[model samples]
Target: GRPYRSHLRPACDACRRRKSRCTTTESSDACLMCQVHGSQCVFVDSDQSRRRKVPTPHGRASSYTESGGSNVDHDDTSISMAYSGETHTHNALSDGQSHHHGPAVLVDPGRPHASAITGSTEEASMSAMLAESGDSNTHIISPAIVDDNEELDSYLSSNPAVGIRRITRTSSTSTNIGPSSRRVLFNTVLKKPLGIHARQSLAASKLEVIEKLLEPHGTVLIDLHTSFRRTYSEHKDRLSPALLSNLYANAMTYWNNSPQLRSCHPPDHRFIWVQANEALHSELFLSPGISTVISIILNVHGRPSTSMFGNGGMVGTAVALSNSLGLNRDCSAWDISPGEKALRSRIWSIVVLMDRWTSLAYGTPLLIHRAQYDVPVPSKEQLAQPNASIAQYAGLSIFLAMLTLTDVLSHYLENVYCISRTSPIDRPPTSSFHLETLLTDWEDSLEDDIRRLVIRGNDLDRAGSGNLRLSYLAVKLLLRRILCDTTNATTENEGAVQARLQTQRVAEEIVLLVQELSHSHLRGFWMPSNGFTLTSATLFLLRDALKTTNRTRNTSLKLAKDMMSSLQTHRVNDSWDLADDCLSNCTDMTDRIEAGRTFESPGMIESQYFIDNNSLMFNDPVLGFASAFDFDLENFQWNETT
Candidate 1:
């Protein structure tokens, strides 16, 4: 008779285990068993079932075949097989079976088909196995138990199949796991078993330390202490382990850097840094708000090696987060409280300012385009409200002024430094003239008190005055760089001469400002200033000194030398040796002039030097004037007649 082939499909694991019939109306959807049990009805292929057949004592087993021809005997009655692809296979062997067949899954009669069981069944099986052994000490092999490789050999006797075949476990190597896995592993390994009270105490201690360290600068943009306390009290869930760790890391870094705390033993800053990074990347704390911004700022500012030009992605992330929160839009129409709205406005302003600064520093495109945001600048009265703290008022005032200053910078960047079909080389003279007019207007528009604060350094807070003045000088330098293009002989025209003269005056202003700042005890106030303004001033003075053989040349050389000395004293990260090399060259030229010899220009040698080192010159940290459309200073020739 012909063999009868059943037309009905085989039952799924659940149905088969329950000894119930399984039915599927469609091939793509769940079967009756899955629908009723609310479980996945996975059907094993006919070939797969056939492959699971028990092998004869001499016949090669499927396990052996699947394991790349490794010899494994499957005749042991204690051993069983399971069909789950996601789980590891366990084999148990009877004493009669050869141990030479790969590691055997040890089975207990109490745990019937334990290899094929899971959940409550597996738990019940383990309990029953313990009772059946009577001694209550019978060893039950489980997946968790199998994770220990050292205990593997003692559990099973030598079997060629088991000994030769490696047991795969989850990788301990951090590099192999995803960020989430690494974070989980880090939390598990580094977590301390401190009580809730202890954790709160530790957090309080850290917050105190951070506030003290950050006190000198004052909380300008975001009030870290206030935000943290508010969140900790009311929105505790919002503060994740990552955020706390990052906050601690930032505070610790500041503390460690503090001159007063240099003798104290700090925690492993690197570990805290990694933890903070993990927290930032974790899915638990992606909310865009003051906390996230503070975290970003701390991460960047805490790391001494962090460069303004580098870490564009981190800056971009912050910009994106700010945008997502609609920080770019005016929130007056919203029903939010006045204080909250004010905070948002200030943060948005800061984000925009930072975006522009980074753009200027790295020659990167601006993240916050002027057209995308309409948030009005906060008024001085609004920032100086009675509710605002003294520090807050001071910080916001300076921030507001700096924000306005950046507006001018942003325009300069868009108009002159922007890349387009009409390169800066092709920029019309009127365009540069209009930008200069804008700069002059911006300076003129400054409040009389603020102007006095900048020039006289009296009465008003000096927190942002230096930055505002330096920014003005930087913009002036940028405009002058454009107007004094040596490649265009037209620069020698009357208009060009006027531009050069203005540029010289701006350069002189920068040197004077630097000298003033250097002499003051509040020099640290200007430490936040990049190397751009000073670097540009130095180069300009050096170049002018080289072109002139008069007494003013000596004065220019002296100023240039003085500026370089101040930069060195400040330990400004030179990244490039432009300052040092420029000072050396200026000294040599000055000596020749002093010797009363006709100073011969280096000509192509100087041009090649400028050309080869153009990147270093434009990208100078102190001189944030370099933008995407930077002028080719290398093209400037030493005119025998200035």
Candidate 2:
């Protein structure tokens, strides 16, 4: 077999490096190594190449033809560098052109030109080889192409090569359109705008900012407090005295309507059905000072729109005096430091008013008629019930009035004892709402006030002497203690000490008042003249006082034993029962219907501000009756007198 030599074109450089076959087809780009690696396969430039000097349309020459050559320069093998700024021109040939080359111009390699080259051809042979190679690969892709297909000129405007050539002739009549359109196309793809996506992300970020502004404590506290203030002011002036009388019932309306705050209670007629001390969620009123201010406002102005007490004086007084003494802060009276002068005064002020109201409400008897006003009589069944009406709150009002008085008096006494211990005041004492001055002023007004309360209590007794006696007894004991003598005989250093001593003395006097009430003769059977009796309650009071008072343990014990003895004697005699039935019936009728519970044991008179309800018994002896025949001492059963 003869070797086929002259017709075999030079091998591509890429095929030599990979040790793979080279087709040796002239101007074809594909070689075995480029095909296997899937890399770009292109013609390599050498000294003998005719394609080495192709002109670049732009400023730089094409790397494909940068070197001008004719001889095979095999030894000048410096590694070829890629052109930094370069471009190349490719021919756009029309179909059926006849720039003839041997063997159908075998450029149809199906892949890009291989980089493999061995420079052995002369310059003339290289040109001939390119002609054959270019002719073989050229094809008429679409003969019926329209001129409008060059619309890519608008999209890739600077790259002229990207414009369609239309292939008018199939063979060698091709034009090399400029290469700028490819650059234009690349820039268009790389620098695309993204305005819409950015705007959406920004909008979402703004919404998050707004949500955060509404989340903190500053916003919620401001809104809620403002609402409460607005509500309070709007209704305040509109409340009338008559309306104020039922403020408790009215305040319940506000609590019911607000759903968030409403879960704290069941739907009920009363905002607080249980007693004040028993309220489960009263802490919802969170302000420490709000209750005190409300009390003061009610005390001076009749009632706050939100009050439960129709009249405000007593509640206000209690809050003001208690806050002043710091009693409201601590439930246990014993917790206060004995050395706290201000506290002692406030406490004693409460004690004074409590005592004064008791004396006026309970110590005096009710008159049946104004004509017989100075004279006392048992009020008819209609007039004696406790708290007959809001007007009767005046007895309770007197207790409230004493708050400031007791406060100042206790303070002055402390100071007076402190100063008087060494020397009498070089200056005369001045008056400034002190307890003594209050007592003096009250005394000036007392006759009228006492007359009024007595008339009112009588009016209540006339209504029904239900728990009136209990209220009366409490007020009497309270007032009697206040009237116990206080002296300036003590020196200045002893003023505070004396006030304390005086307070103890007052408590002792109160105990005495209770004992006296217990021993007071019962007009019918064992029904006391006071119209009600609570011998057990008196003992209870003594026991409670022992827990709170600073009195010696022995003294409290002795007093307690004495009260217990009295209770035992009274209960054992069987006479207390004679009055039990009548008292019990009166209590049931009065307590349920009474607007304000004022019934009390004589010992509670020292706390006139309370709405205390004491247990009671009526004066009907069913035990001795033996089927109703042996009783009825008033009517004399069977016309017989025991």
Candidate 3:
């Protein structure tokens, strides 16, 4: 076809230069582009005599006429530009409607049109497109829509489009926001208002179990019962979501780790532990020192056997947080209340004690030094007050005694087992004697009530006292074993004999203690005892049974069997596997000794054979039993009197 042309009016200069179709009505003075650009309309000369096709004026003028002449211009190009702009605005409005669940009106009554051309053509074209597309929900911007300033403000305020833009802007810049800023934003936008009834329901259902589990240990470090009560009473005003989530995580961990619960329900500790672990990373509790410490404690307590090294590192983090909060400093000089000061002191003391105990357990270096913190210990008066809650009084005396015991252990570790200054060969024998004296003195200083609790208390009290006594016994056993090892490494026979005798005495003490506690008591005490004392005692019995030929051998073998049987009943971890293997090894050794005597080949029994066979038993360093006795003692001359 030949080039199409508008015979009614020639194209304007700007439209002709752009090769775009242009039309004008009797009402317009310029093309839409020329008018929009504020330029004069100069049309190109065309062959007016030729009859050219003139389409009907289906542009802005007709639409304005159709809309009852609503003061709109007759410019097709301007109407197209306005339509494109409103199309973009319409898409944005649609997105806002979907996201915010609101109406799809694109036009803001408060925002005026950016140009003089009315949007009547744009609205009519959009309506036609929506109708053709079968969309009945399309909202069009009306040219005559008007509102007062207050109404406009209210519309803008209630409009989802504005809120969407604000949200978009915030998310776009969220990377630059700090944790506290993000926390504030989350609290405002994401956190739902949880009611007290719901919180109490959670507390009564799950947190109560946690409080019970924690009550045994919360007397000194954390008063979970009191804290829970306070939180239940003042959660809306005082507790942060992070703290609440952290507490929930801890409760889940306690629930998961409870042996009673595990026996009833299938094992879900891994799932609950992971959930609790993720809550620790939340930004809300990142800066709060006490919550962080509580999280560490719960984590350590949850997996006592597997998390040794990890818990050591967490203890370092706790110490750093404690120091950052000035918890290491004496709070007495501060203007805080005496109760607050006492609580702070107790927390610091707990951190210090935890650092020492974990360091000793994992053979890691201590994080908190004794001289670094001057926080006072809790007074007896504070512990004995009648107003003390169950959580406050439950383990009060035990905790105080443990504080003193941990102090003694810390001193013993520094002086006798200080890795930096001493090696096994370099440590003097007198160091063990010195620590023994100190340990004895420390035990002597314990109150008579504590002694009575350990000797004759019922099941619950006996378990607690057994835990305390086991700790002291473990330290004493460690010292004696160290002395024995150091002395055995020497060529001096006299010192070796003395160290061996002392080790046997300590071992016998431990065996007696273990025998005194029932199987249920031992099972209850297993978690707190860490199996160190039990393992040591079992090793001693095995060694005595193998090395002796007198009637004491029968007693030693019987005791070893009983202890192993008790340990076999409870499966805390792989530690019990080593115990079982030791028991088997002892039974075999006793059988061989009896067989050799019966066959008149007692001299044929060789120490080298026993050493070669039993060396594999203690390959696990945690067992540490293979080196407790010299299986090659046949090489040394026996002294019957010694």
Index of the highest-lDDT prediction: 1
Lowest lDDT sum, 10 consecutive residues, model 1, at 182-191
**Candidate 1 versus the native: TM-score?**
0.52
Flag the better candidate by lDDT, 1 or 2: 1
In candidate 2, position 501 carries an lDDT of 46
Give candidate 3 misplaced runs (Cα > 4 Å): 1-233, 236-267, 281-288, 383-386, 389-394, 421-433, 454-463, 486-495, 518-529, 539-558, 571-642
lDDT of 2 by residue, 1-642 (tens): 322322236445444334455553355456544555433344455444434445556442122112211111111110100111111111211111123311112133242322222222221222221121111112112212322224332442232122111111111111232232211100101000211101112212322333233234212222222212222344332222111212232233233223344345433333222222211112112111222222232222211122223222333344443333222222111211222222223333332333222212222211111221111111112121222344334333333323333333333333322334456564235333344554455435434644344323332221112222233333333322232223333335466445434444433443443344332222111112122123223322333342333322335334434544443454455233323422333333323322122344333432432333222211211011000000011111011112
Per-model TM against the reference: 0.52, 0.21, 0.51
TM-score of 3: 0.51
Error of 1 at 586 (Å): 12
After superposing all C-alphas onto the true structure, candidate 2 shows an RMSD in angstroms of 43.1
Which one wins by TM-score: 2 or 3? Answer: 3
Q: Compared with the true structure, what per-residue lDDT tens digits does model 3 show for residues 72-93?
A: 1111000000211221122221
lDDT of 1 by residue, 551-585 (tens): 43466667766776654554453222223433443
Per-model lDDT: 0.46, 0.27, 0.44
- Positional deviation of 274 in candidate 3, in angstroms? 2.1
Off by over 4 Å in 1: 1-278, 283-290, 301-305, 308-310, 384-392, 422-433, 455-461, 486-498, 518-529, 542-555, 572-642
